[model samples]
Target: MRQFDRGEIHARLRAVMDRGEPIVMGGAGIGLVAKAAERGGIDILMAYNTGPFRMAGHGSLAGYLAYGDANAMTLELGREILNAVDDTPVVGGIGAADPFRDIGRLIGEMMDLGFSGITNVPTTGLYDGKFRAHIDATKLGYPREIDLIRMCRDRDVFTVAYAFSTDEARAMAEAGADIIGAHVGLTSGGWIGAAATLDIDRACEATQAMLEAARAGRADVLVVAHGGPFEDPESVRSVFERTDVVGYLGASSIERLPVERAVSGVVRDFKALRPRATRTAG
Candidate 1:
């Protein structure tokens, strides 16, 4: 599998960050979406079978549901995405820290499949309080995320760690994540979304906090923001003006959200055309 070392990965990331044109990384559940993102010049493609939840008429949160095997799904889609896109590096959403699976073995398998890097998905980031504690007690929680990224770093495979808080950001950065994505809940305002309760300014503040924590661990940790107020480019730009994040991750934003808007308007336009009562001319 073609792979980018840590230096090359950061160089590519820096090139996009330096240009200020925005680095576009899309999460795709299917081949068509992956192909489309590549055509649009997306810098990276993240594959998680859960992305198909929208195709099944469910929300992106369905990616975290108990239905499918997360690792299995990602590898299945990751390979297909690589085949569909010409050169865009694909990130596999590994279900890190699952006690039922050997994370080390899983990482090796992901590398063998030609993945350019890995990221945590179907993450336990959203859970909190007793539920979160219970997961951690079982040893199948975020520690797995840290270990998984560390393993990848050992091999020099690129890694993007999804952290929901400043503390999590610190742990991930210290664990050697090449890119630390500060995820702020689910992308909202679309069909089947968790309301993005945090205002844009607050989200930016939180992202800055996360960046500060990561930098405290490693000065060069590349930080990106995703979800919530980052559901669109305009929203991201709003936050960008307020924070120092390096980039954004457009899962629902780039894929389902735009498709929903565009397809709705397109169908409406087609339906609006006058009927045969007007006598059509070619």
Candidate 2:
């Protein structure tokens, strides 16, 4: 109901985590998760998939020029996702050729749609030599990207940086990332490329390494884990148990379910988890 700042989101998430109740925020497709966050008092985090742009190759760059509007169906899908949530900020464009330009377009769209803050996974875009070299020559840093950090900070936008390695996490924190999330089992292409066999062992290893790096850098970062081939609630819970991650993020698991069924299931689960004090005092 209330508009949230970056600090508010981080503090509320940390408070939730401190109480030993793992904050469960859905990754992408703002439709269901945004509504879940608003009604369930849960935090919401969205990671936009820019893989299509990459897959389309340079010739398809025209689509991006129109802010990807040429694909109205995709935009409509995004709208469907956003429509399900109320007052939940929509983080946009995880991997992009020009992050600043993409972010600007996304922010403008969100603003026009009356959405909240924007967050992203900037470093994940540089998985190749060309992008990596661009970052390096610009003195913006690479693998441990910093340009987006600076841009978001300057704009006072909430940002979440995905770090595949401990060093990447530390560097992002040092670069002024508001939230440093560990992308365990995450591939360069996004959730679509995430392996189904991903397990807690790998999740734990990545989380621990990220925690150590964040602490070593003396950075107060809000850590999150995502990109596992989640099969069920137990598997999802296992990831939380193995790591100090405050929340998890991903869309493939939920997307695989019938949209109606998934939405109803999420609603039921939220209701079941409601605190007893708010449960009609029965």
Candidate 3:
């Protein structure tokens, strides 16, 4: 198959949105996402390294350092994983950083590895004080975000920005985000509570607010509703019905299950939802 340029990917996404199909955004650790994408089980894959991973001594610190220094190990590992999946678009990057330089480096590495896009959460307000402090110390403002967006745009790479509110989503869109991802809960720690304890009504309200924010910003930009505590597909579908979100991303729910089982179940569910063809005279 021919490699798709950024314009081609964007056009494909727009066409998918036009059909009102939800882009199944599977979120997992870098390794899992790359593995799933390689199996052709995911439509879009988000490589997110949450805070807990760092606290738990999961090589996140090493990854961060590697990213900062453009370490060959990090770049090679990222490329190797991404290159495993030929069909799925693997959007690479950790969920925590500013993503200006990190994204650029990742994109360069991914391109070398034969991947196309990169994803990250570039918030004006960092969820953690340390993260905020880092950004502030660096003196990188919203303009840096705008510059990142322009850079991605120039490369034809897709950029997904996660915002906590409709206002934030709109601000990100204005700042040049190609995709606006909404955070429906306490996004700092990356844990959105449990499915049983989740307030469905509040989630719906948040989804509506995000949709309104996306509409107010740029109708052309893709909106993705994420952050979980949603109990089931019904709960997810409820938000999907009201929001302009073309995709969903979450780890809490899926991670709650055994990885292999969760992956198989999700793939089965996706297949089950497909319309059966009518039997015509052959």
lDDT tens per residue, model 1, 1-282: 246555676678789877876666889888888889888988888887668786566887777768878788887887777788777788888887565778888878887887888888878886778989999999878887888888888888889899999899999999899888898888887777676458888889999999999999899888888888678778898877888887788888878887888889999999998889775756
- Write one digit per residue (lDDT tens) for candidate 2, span 173-272: 7766766666665322232343344456766676778867965665566676665444345666776777776666544443333343555789999878
Error of 2 at 233 (Å): 2.9
Task: Write one digit per residue (lDDT tens) for candidate 3, span 98-131.
Answer: 4344656655765665545655532344344677
Clashing pairs in 2: 31-81, 35-85
Off by over 4 Å in 1: 1-3, 277-282
lDDT of each: 0.82, 0.54, 0.56
Give each model's clash number: 0, 2, 0
User: Which of 1 and 2 is the better model by lDDT?
Assistant: 1
* Segments in model 2 whose C-alpha atoms lie over 4 Å from true places: 30-33, 36-41, 50-83, 94-96, 99-115, 121-145, 187-198, 229-231, 257-282
Count: clashes, candidate 1: 0
Query: Candidate 2, TM-score vs. the true structure?
Result: 0.64
Which candidate order results from sorting by TM-score in descending order?
A: 1, 3, 2
For model 3, the superposed segments whose C-alpha errors exceed 4 Å read 1-3, 18-20, 30-33, 37-41, 51-77, 94-106, 121-146, 186-198, 254-282
Winning model by TM-score: 1
- Alpha carbon deviation, residue 4, candidate 2 (Å): 2.2
